[model samples]
Target: MVNVNCNILQAVDKNLMIADKIFRSRLMVGTGKYETVQIAKQSIHASGASIVTAAIRRLQINHPFEEKSLFKYLDWNSLWLLPNTAGCTTVEEAVRAASLGRELCKKIGQSNNNFIKLEIIPDYKYLLPDPIGTLKAAEYLINKQYTVLPYIYPDPVLAKQLEELGCSTVMPLGSPIGSGQGLKHLDSIRVIIENAKVPVIVDAGIGTASDAVQAMELGASAVLTNSAIANAQQPHIMASSIQLGVQSGRLAYLAGRMNELTQAQSSSPIIGISS
Candidate 1:
C-alpha cells in the first residue's frame, strides 16, 4: 500500500484528539435529538467524531425490561462519551453531577481519567452559564482529579480563573445554545484563545460548517456542537461538512495568513521590464 501523507490524514492523526488521554474524531458532537438512536449514530460516524457529549442525569436511566440500552446504539469503543451537567444551575448541582459522571464512567468500564463537560446554567430562558457557580464547581472538581471542561461565556478573565483552578480546558459559548448565531462573540472568543494556556473550545451556537471553520481559524483548539448538526435536514452530510471545515480552518491557522493592503497589485507596466 502506498503511504498517503495528506493534510486530512495528518489532521486525523494529530489534531483528532486532546490532552486528556482520549482519542477523538476532532469534531465533538452531542447525543441529542434525532428521529432515532440509529440516526444519531449514523450522523456521528459521518461527522467523523470520536468525542461525543451526553448529559449525565437521573432521567436517562434504563427502565427495567428495556430491550436496548443507549450504549447499544453506537460504537462505544470508537467514541469518548463526555458526560455534562446540562441542567445544573448552581455550584453544588454541578459538583454533584461531575461526581456522578465519574462514577458512571467507572461502572461502564471507562478509565479513571475522568473528563466532565461542566455546564451551570441559571437562566432557564437564555440558558447562559452562571459564571460564579461554574467557577466554584470547576475548582472543586479539578481538585478532586477530574478533568473539567466547563461551558461558559466568552470571558477571558473567567477563563484565566478556570485555568488557575486546574481546569483541563475552557469551553466558551459562541452565542446561545441552539441559537445558530455563528460566533457572535468573535472578539471575546479571540481574546480567550490568545490568552489561554490550555485548549479553548468554542462550544454551542455554531450554526454551520463555516462557523466551525471560522472558530478554528480564530485559534480555537476545537469546536463542540449539537443542534447544528443533529437537527440538520441531512445530519450525516452536515457532519461530514463540519469535519472538513474544522480541518480546513485549523490548517489555515497553522499555515499563517497574508497581510492586507489598500493599494492594488501591479500586474505589468508599473515601472520597467517591458518586452
Candidate 2:
C-alpha cells in the first residue's frame, strides 16, 4: 500500500489552477510602488511569481507597451499579465478600466488574456474596498468573459456571494491597502477559506514573509502583495524571502500542523525513577 504522507506530499506539489490556467508559483507580484522600473523588474524575477499585475492607468501613462514600458522588462509569454483597475472608484469606471486593460493586454501580445484585478474603492482616507461596487463590477466583468479577481473585505458572507457570482477568485483583504497590518482580519479570513468554493487569495496588508506564511498556512490559495516587496529596503531579497516563506507555509499545511493543547507535553518522556 502507498504511504499516506508521501501521497499527500505529492498531491500538495501540484500546480495552482485559476480560471483554467495553471501556475507553478502561488505568489503574485505587482508592478507598483517600486523606486525604479529596474528594481521592480528584479523583484518580480526574485519573487518567482508567475502572475504579475499592473495598474491599467499606470500602464497607459507610462508608454503603454512601448520599449520603455514595464511590460518590456519581463517575458510576457512566461508571466501572466493581470490588469488592475486600481484608481477606479465606481462600477462604471472599473468596468471601463477593465476593458482598457484588455486592450493593453492585447497590445502586449497576450491577446487571449482576459484577467482583471477588480478594485472599487470609494473611500480615500482608509482606501477600503466598496463591496457593493466590487460585486457590481465583478458581475459585469465575469459576464464579459474576463477572469475577475476581486479585492474585498474578509467577510465570509461577501466571500460566498462573490463565489456564487462566478468569480475566478475572491481576494479578501488582510488589512487596508498598503497598510502592512498583516492579516488584521485573520479569523474572518479563515472562515472564508473554510467556506470558499473558489480560491481564497489574501491580498494586500502583507508586510513581510511572515505575513505570506501565515496566509498560506491558513489555506489561502495564494497571496498577492506589492507594497511588502516593492517598499522593502532590499526589494529583491525581500521578494525571495516571501517566496521561501510561502513554500514553507504550503509545506507545513500539507504536512498537517500539530493540534494545539491546553497543557504542555514533554518532547521526550522520562522513565519513572524510584522516589
lDDT per model vs. reference: 0.81, 0.88
How do the predictions measure up, each by TM-score? 0.90, 0.93
Instruction: Give the TM-score (vs. native) of candidate 2.
Output: 0.93
State the lDDT of candidate 1 residue by residue for 1-275, as single tens digits.
Answer: 12122445475446544554755445799987777777887888887777888887733443411444456666666677788999888888888888777766765567664899999998999999988988888888877888889899999999999988898889999999999899999999999999988889999998999999999899888899999988899988888888888877877787777877899876576566666
Off by over 4 Å in 2: 1-11, 61-63, 272-275
The sequence of per-residue lDDT tens digits that candidate 2 reaches over residues 123-200 is 989998999999888898898999999999888999899999999999999998898889999899999999988888
Residue 155 error, candidate 2, Å: 0.9
Model 1 clash count equals 1
Compute the lDDT of residue 257 as modeled in candidate 1.
78
C-alpha positional error of residue 240 in candidate 1 after TM-score superposition, expressed in Å: 0.5
Which stretches of candidate 1 lie above 4 Å from their native place?
1-13, 20-24, 62-69, 267-275
> Residue 54 deviation, candidate 1, in Å?
0.4
Model 2: how far is 37 from its true place, Å?
1.3
The CA lDDT at 64 in model 2 is 74
Which candidate number would show the highest lDDT if scored against the true structure?
2
